[model samples]
Target: MPVSSENKNGPYKPQPIKKVSTTTVVNPGFFAYTNLTGCQPYYCAEQVHLINNITVTALTIIIRVQKTSAATYHGVANNFWTGYINSNHTDNGSQIIYTFVLDPTQTVVASTTWYVEAQMDLYGTSQVTSADTYTVSVTGGGITNSYSGHF
Candidate 1:
C-alpha cells in the first residue's frame, strides 16, 4: 500500500544535485532510518520508512547500511528488496546495498509515497541493542547522497 514519509530526521537530503543529472529531483529531502533503542532492540531489525517520490521521471533508489561494530547480520530490508547482502561473507560490521526500481507502469505514482526500512543485528544469546552509528545513502540515476544515523 502507498504510504507517507515517517522519517524522524526527514527525507535524505541530496548534498549536491550537481553530481547527478541536472534533470534529477529529490523528494522529502531527508533519509529515513531508525537507530536501535531500548524500546525496539533487536539484531538486524530494520526500521521502516515511507518514501514520498514526487518527480517527473521514475525513481530508482539504492539503500546502503553501514555497521561499525561486529554483527551477525547487517543489511537493509526495504521496499525494493529484503535481506540484501553484497558479500557472501557476513559478520561483524558491514555495508549492505539494496535497490528498488519504480517503473512508470507500477501502481506507485510519481507524486505518491512508498515504504522503506533498514536494520542490523549482532550475534549473541541475548538481545544486545544499542545505538550504533550507521550511514544510509540513497542513490538514483541523477540523485545521490548519504545520511548518518544510528540503529
Candidate 2:
C-alpha cells in the first residue's frame, strides 16, 4: 500500500567537508646525524564548524618529503629511513592516503615539509615543525568546492 506524503521522512543525507593539516621537523639529534636515532611527530585535528546538520565519516592525510642536498650521504640516508604520520583523531572507516618515517641519513641542508588533505563523509570543520607551515584542503558537497589555508 502507498503511504501518505506526511508520513515520509526527509531527503537523503550528504557527507560533510573536513579540514586537515601536517608538519615536519629537523631536530638536532633526530634525523640529523648518522645514527638515525631520533623521532618526529605529526598531528591532525577535525571539528564540526556547523550545527548538527552534518557529520564526518572519513579522513586521509598525504605528506611529501623532498631532499635539498645531493650529497652522497644525504642521498643514501634518504632511501634508508622512512616517514610516518600520527593522529589522535578517531577514524570513521576512512583510509589514510600515505604515511612516511623520517630518514636519518639525510643532511641538515635537506628541506622537508608535509602536505595533508582530508575527506569527510558527513559538514565538519577544522601544525608544524622545522620552520614549516601547515596547509589544509577541504573537499565535499555544496558545488564540489575546495579551499586552502595556512596555520
Each candidate's TM vs. the true structure? 0.42, 0.19
Cα lDDT tens digits, model 1, 1-151, are: 2233333346554232222333435434433444222222336544434343433234444445454434444444444433222222233335554454444453333433345444445444333334333343454344555444444
lDDT of each: 0.40, 0.21
Per-residue lDDT for 66-137 in model 2, tens only?
A: 111110111111221134323322222322222222222322122332222222221121112122122222
Superposition error at 2 for model 1 (Å): 11
Local lDDT at 48 for model 1:
38
Local lDDT at 40 for model 1: 28
Task: Enumerate clash totals for all models, in the order shown.
Answer: 17, 10
Evaluate model 2: give its TM-score.
Answer: 0.19
> Candidate 1: where is the Cα deviation over 4 Å?
1-41, 44-57, 72-93, 103-107, 124-151
Candidate 2 global lDDT? 0.21
- Candidate 2 segments whose C-alpha is farther than 4 A from its true place: 1-54, 57-60, 69-137, 140-143, 149-151
